[model samples]
Target: MPSPSGENPWSIPENDRLSERDFGRIAELIGEHAGIKLPPTKRLMVEGRLRKRVRGLGHQSLADYCRFLFDGHGLTSELVHVIDAVTTNKTDFFREPTHFVALEEKIVPALLERHASPEPRIKLWSAACSNGAEVYTIAMVMAEIAARHRHLRFSVLGTDISTEMLEYAAQAIYPVAMVEPVPTALRNRYLMQGRAPSRRSEVRIVPELRNTACFARLNLMDTRYTIDRDVDVIFLRNVLIYFEKATQEAVVSRLVGHLRPGGFLILGHSESMIGSNLNLRQVAPAVFQKS
Candidate 1:
């Protein structure tokens, strides 16, 4: 049978073909476990990603690999690898800078007006902080705020579903080009370049920002989050595009539960909360405030 789009379904290399049934099952498991919705459209992408895992694990066929994930007995370690492969982790420093601009221009000033106190603490959560860019971006902005308002304290809690990504975040080491988008002054202030020969082409987050930040593994499918109860901002950008509407609502609800009453919730530019039925009021492009 021709593919739904009137092209070859088996266009993927015959050596690493992912059958329709296996793709469906994998999609279902990923959706159920990680709240990531995978449809037939993602078959090629999924196949390309999981193919590496299949080869690395020495599974001769895609069927054997799927079986290892679904039916194989008592191999929890393989499941983590499969889930890690299926999830997307595309992000970089100062991504969606307008949001950070908004934080400085509108959100933070309003927060200061309402929540200022002795030894003030501003807690923010980078909900889908892929790698470490978004968390450190928040840290950089907060670092600026802290310098100006010496009384204010800033703490960022970065969370993700994939342990591998969280591990990368914990180290806070990234390529040289990754920090290139950061302006010169901020880059010098917040990033440390590796020395020649051994550690070339790399930069790590400065120790002070690293000390102010922390990371945790969190699957948005869960009902309760493992972060602090109250937070002033949540940067859940770009990741929700992978989830279906119902999944988005469920995840947003859980995130909303952790946000302070008047705190800000920022979604990706493409994602939306219209008719999401959550108790949030839109304040900017993809930005919302909990009422």
Candidate 2:
């Protein structure tokens, strides 16, 4: 039933009445702007994610929100929030544990052996590092390796397309429960408890760890990366599924160019490099070494 005074479509129970043409329009524009592809299979998901934004912005429907965004002369102001809502940002401590395993067991030792002389400077990039779980994980591993090496230094760089996510990454604060998956020894060494009773128990990354890592906003679609210097390793995991094949190849190629010779490039377990023409050799499943 409508309001006692009159009907209100904005008050309707369903906000998913997105038309086919509008879906295509929104998907195309998002791809053009953010390099995020919204296929037909994601039409429902896109609508669901946009509903809250549309309602929050006081639009009656997704169609209206799209019209406002596409037709308005200067709706660029709202585009940021729209992209933030649509982008995937789910991450956790030690996500895909195997990658970390391979990192510690195989990659680090090899890098250490290869650059054993003169105390090499280890540099790592966590591209699309949402909220910094991956960055911290890398830091922990480097800290362990450093504990033994004594002379080597490390710098971990975290980058993402979302400015909001980058802010959270820089903060390095998380609920205590979220960091449980991190090993106990590393936890004790690198994570400090947040001791305020008023707030729920949480953990802050130790200053030593935070100091070694930095965050930046970066869009992977760009032809040239702003970080021009060669990096020793790159952890670009679980982000390519959002792009088309051509995009995946392009991104992989770009990542390869930055890797110092024989540097490691780790992708999500499910992401592949079968046909990618990057100058990389598969050293392990989903782990490639620049040629």
Candidate 3:
């Protein structure tokens, strides 16, 4: 059959093509376990992404991979890789520039004033932090704020379902092109150029900024998050668009419980509509504050 992309699955060698039945099973498992809705349109994409996994696992075909996963007890060990393969990690430093502007100009100052401690420690979370860009971005903003306000301290927690991404994020290295979105001044302040010739095309977040950031693997589909509940700002951006509406609301509601009173929740620009009923007030474009 011709897939949605107008490619005939049968045109590929039989061992490489994914059958309809196997695609359906894979879609069901991904939706059930990850809350990501993989409709028919995504079949070709999924099949393409999993081909490397099939070869890596020494499977002869997509069918054999499915059988190994479903019938041959490979799922328990392979599910994480499956999820990693499918979950899209589209992120860049300062991807949405205005969000950081608001964080630095408005949000952080407001939170600092409201905090009662002698030396306030602001807690920021990048809920679906992909490769640590968002977390490090937040750290850069917080570092600037802390410099001006001598009594302030901050920590950033970056969590993602992809252990693969979390590991990459922990390393804090990126192609020089990826850091281009960061402002020149902040880039100079927070990023260190690689000293070795082979690594010259890469930059690493400075040890000082890296020390303020931490990464962890967290499944948002899980009912409870094991991190701090007094988060001053939660950046749950972009990833929500991939979920069903009901799942979107459920995830946002749970995250809302983690925010301190007057703390902020920032969603992707497209996600503004989902959390209207959850004790939040729209404070900016896709930015919400807990009452």
Candidate 4:
């Protein structure tokens, strides 16, 4: 059959062959290192992404890349690139504005009522924070709210597996086109226009807002990352769809483990705990509370 592009699907050579044992090895390697599962289907997907890497690196086959990964060359770096390629990071300023509104109206107030004391602290994690927009948006909201409530403090921790994305996040800069949907008042308050070192002058989030958040390179698959301070809310949004059933369960368990008792866990609107079987109770629309 011809593909939608009108090219014969079979005309292309079978670029990669993923054996059952190789699939198991891929799953074990990814799971042990990054808590990601490479099911047979996803293993094929990985093969497709790495097929070009094989050509680029002058390797004979996908098996060669696997061997390179095991020969102490530490393909974790390359694996991270593969993840960056496969993971979709489509987000914008206040993409789901209602959740921020709810946080401002209901959640933040409730958290303050309980924890508003000397050095009162609130910790939030953007588990799959991509390119920093969501993290910065959360920071802007918290900073605005905290300014009004002197008795409370808040900090945001944005973590992602892609070092390339983190570099953009750390720079705290975005192009003008990316800021179109941002409201003017908020844009002026939170973002400033200036020349980057190379990309010329561009719009950037104000240092005051940027200062309130921190970005880290983290792989969500790591099971032992226990953030010492209990988190009040976690924005593990829009990133779980790529995982398989068992992998999704393991990731949720690790996520809930980091969540403080009674803390809220939010996922992408399309994602749900219906089949996830995680230990969380539905509190609001698309929102789950740790038991």
Candidate 5:
């Protein structure tokens, strides 16, 4: 039964057919504008995520919300929210721990030998560093390595597209659940577990580890980024899956451009530099060294 006006699609009850088309249009628009690729088959998931956004904006219909997004309003904010909601950020301390061990055993030593000084400095970038477990873990490794070497200095800069996620990273606090998987020694050394006087429980990163990291918001799709200097290593893991093939190549090219010659590029275990013509050669499983 249609409403009195008969043209208000909002009044037409929500159903599979209605959602499918709108979702496809949204996917197309996002891909065109931001290089994010969402398959048509994911229409239901997209609708489910955007339904809350539409309701929050007090739009009576998905069509209205879609129109608002497409009509040249401040839609980037909503799109960022959509990306944050849809992207899988499942990560933990020393995820794919072998990579960390390899860095400790071989890469760090080679870098130290190359510099041959009392204090050799390096900078690493954690691209798409969601909520910053990876960045903090990188700090932990640096600290541990520095302790043994007594002649190394390192810092990690973590960047993400979501402000909400960056806020979480800045606080350097996590619930007990977040620290449970961390190695016992590392947890004790790097994380301060306690409750402040006025509030709930929290685990804070110690000053030594916290000082070694900086977090910021950066849209990888944006060509005019502020990262001015070359980086020694970049962990651009698991983010390319959200992009189309061309976008993936572009993103990889941009990331590779930031790496110093002979620096490392690390991707997720399931990710690779497929279809990307970067000057990086695979050195290990999911690890590539820039040539």
Candidate 6:
């Protein structure tokens, strides 16, 4: 129904649309800062995502919000929020089951066999961990292995550019439906159900597994990463599709530098074409090993 002003209250005002110039500027900013492309076709998505920021800042339209962001000295404070708004963070527990199977059956045993120390530590990183699912899944696998192999120690690191996601990851809470992909045995071992009525639909990662994982905010576009250089495995999955080829190559190369010799680098199945030029050998589908 139309409002008293003779406009549809449920409809967005025409003036709220993002102008082409603003969209271009936003695209440029996001590309330069995050290495993720935002072509003209993504303008609607960008506009829709930024609407929350616009309303939060009390702006009447996209133009006003952009002006505040670009011209009125809001960029320094608003840039992270803008990037968070536009970034896509679709993920699931055990999104690709094969990757974990290979990690367990092949990667861990191989790394352990090559270790020189009597007690060795295996480190796994989730390079674009969205909400901690992948890292927790990794911890679960490692925990089960550690049960039998008393001399083995493992830690998992989950990193993403989104602080919001980092917070969510650190909280280690997830909706019941999101964890259905987890196996029954691992789920029973690593997950704890919420007891209260209002929280019954949620599950929290077991503290034992949570202690084995840590979360950090890291940007892939940076020339250097502050992470350790001796990581045993790095999961750079399901994220390269958002980058251009050059950015993909650069990010993959930098991540490879962090891997120890013989360490594994795993990409999403769809991103297998990337990193062929790097000093890596294909070990399995979507998996590479640094020499």
lDDT of 2 by residue, 1-291 (tens): 433224443655554456888889878877976788887877666777777888888888887887888787325798677777778887888988887888878888888888857888889999989999989999998888888888889999999988888999899998888898999999999998877785458889999999999998888888899984579899888898888888888888888788888798888888866324566778777888876
Clashing pairs in 1: none
lDDT of prediction 1: 0.83
- Give lDDT: candidate 5, residue 182: 80
Question: Stretches of candidate 3 above 4 Å error?
Answer: 1-11
1-291, model 1: which lDDT tens digit per residue?
554324455564665667898899888878888888887888877877777778887998777887777788524777677788889899988888899999888888878887858777889999988798899999999899889987999899998888889999999999898888798999989988898777789999999999999998888888887777689999898877788877888788888888888899999888865324677888888889887
Candidate 1: minimum summed lDDT over ten consecutive residues — where?
Answer: 1-10
| Models, CA RMSD each | 3.8, 4.6, 2.4, 4.3, 5.7, 3.5
Residue-pair clashes per candidate: 0, 0, 0, 2, 0, 0
My TM-score estimates for the predictions, one after another, are 0.90, 0.87, 0.95, 0.77, 0.83, 0.95
> For candidate 2, which ten residues in a row score worst on lDDT?
1-10
Cα lDDT of candidate 4 equals: 0.74
Structure candidate 6, residue pairs in collision: none
lDDT of 6 by residue, 1-291 (tens): 743224454587767877899999999999998999888877777777788789888999999998898899999999889988899888999888899899889998899889999899999999999888889988988999999899999999999999888999999999999999998998899999999999999999999999999999999999999999999999999899999999999999999989999999999999998957687999889999999
Can you tell me which runs of candidate 5 are displaced by over 4 Å? Answer: 1-18, 72-77, 196-201, 273-277
Question: Which regions of candidate 6 are displaced past 4 Å?
Answer: 1-10
Q: For residue 206, give model 6's deviation from the true position in Å.
A: 0.7
- Pairs of residues at least 3 apart in sequence or in different chains that clash in candidate 4: 194-201, 195-201
Query: What is residue 259's positional error in candidate 2, in angstroms?
Result: 0.8
Q: Determine the C-alpha RMSD for candidate 6 after optimal superposition of all C-alphas.
A: 3.5
TM-score of 4: 0.77
For candidate 3, lDDT tens digit of each residue in 1-291?
776446577677876776888888889888888889988888788987888888888889888899998899999999999999888889989988899999988898789789989899999999999899999999998899899999999999999989999999999999999999999999999999998999999999999999999889999999998987889999999999999988999999999999999999999998888866577999888899998
Score residue 260 of candidate 3 by CA lDDT: 93
